[model samples]
Target: MTHATTTDGVRIAYQLQGQGAPLVLLAGQANNHHWWDQVRADFHPARSTLTLDYRGTGDSDKPDAPYSTELFAEDVIAVLDRLGIDRADVYGTSMGGRVAQQLAARHPHRVAALVLGCTSPGGPHGVERSNDVRKALAQPRPEAARQALLELMYTPRWLDSHPGPHHTLGDPGMPAHARRHHLAASNRHDAWELLPDIAAPTLVIHGADDLLNPAANAPLLADRIPGARLELIPQARHAYFEEFRALAGPLVLDFLTTAPSRP
Candidate 1:
């Protein structure tokens, strides 16, 4: 376990794995480094992986103040600085995707390539979960939120084939506090206008069956950004990267490895 101090003086926790060019995995809402566990091994022998738990999630210190995606992007930069990595390919899912885009816009020099998974550029109603999710999370019932999330996160076939009691999304398990923090941070995020300025080569991947954010958002992202490739994984959903790591892993690795270098 390693640590870095963010610009706001928050102690962020992260773990480094593999050995090669650095690749950072920024997890989605209410999730942390553990969310990348299933796919981390696939990047081996090619890219060193840096997975972080943003402040208030995983092993990172939780401050009471409200947080935003911009702050999270800065936290990611600070993590890279602590590891002495000047540039890295970034992979962000959901909330992480927001930070990834913001990072690319604000700190283009630090980012090499970008992989956005199951995410959207937040504007007014960007990727709002169903009202059920809002009520469930607001009720602060961890189990209900988890179950409701699973519905939108995975396709019906994947959920049916999988056994009972799905894997928890968060590292320490999803608690009410984490869910609340996620909702607040998500609401505070807005990165739609900045999409045009992202100079890094980008790959936008989404599950065709994704109910939470819908696969349509992928094309919307690719269409707005210059030279962004959009790939819709068939029969997959939001957490398909975790459920079908075999498929998602190679897709991302290839995207990073084969993308043309930036000028």
Candidate 2:
């Protein structure tokens, strides 16, 4: 475990594992570095992975302020700077993907490659969640909220077969205040206009049955980011990396390891 202090003086926690080229893993809203535990090994042997807790998640400082994607992006940059890493392949899921967009757009040189999974650009162009899911997410109680999240994240068959995975639903242990801030940041995030400015080799992956961030957003991301590749996993949902790690893992590994072809 390691710590990096952001420009705002918030201490962010991170972990470094495996050995090879640096690969940064960013988690979704209200999740921390530990969220990657299940898939962290997928990139081992060929790449060294860095997983960080975004402010307000994991062991990071939970400052009482409105969070934004730009803030999270800066936090990630701080982590890299603290570790003395000049460049790395960056991968983000959901809210983390939103932050990755900001990082690549704002500091393109730091990102050698980019991968976004089950995330949206936000704003009018992005898909909005259904009211039922939204209400469930606002359940106020931790257990209820976790249940709501599981329902929204996994398909029925996957949930039925893997009942134990429910423990992973809210494993980040985010406080209610911090979660509210994260949710606010997510609601306000808008990267549609900024996608074209990303210069790194990029890959966009999404689950075909994703509900939180519809799979339709994948094409928009792939098309907007020049030279970006898109891959859609069938019979998967929002947390495809965990629900279908067997399939999503290899696709991500290949994209991160292989060189991008010139257009």
Candidate 1 structure quality by residue, lDDT tens digits, 181-237: 776877777778888899999999988887777677788888877999988888888
Instruction: Quote each prediction's TM-score.
Output: 0.90, 0.93
lDDT of 2 by residue, 6-100 (tens): 88899999899989998999888888776788778988968999988888888889998899999999999999999999888999999989999
Candidate 1: global Cα-lDDT?
Answer: 0.82
Clashes of 2: 0
Q: What stretches of model 2 exceed 4 Å from their correct place?
A: 139-145, 165-168, 261-263
Q: Which ten-residue region of model 2 has the weakest summed lDDT?
A: 164-173
C-alpha RMSD for every candidate: 2.3, 2.1
lDDT (Cα atoms) of all candidates against the true structure:
0.82, 0.87
Q: In terms of lDDT, which candidate is strongest?
A: 2
Cα lDDT, model 1, residue 51: 91
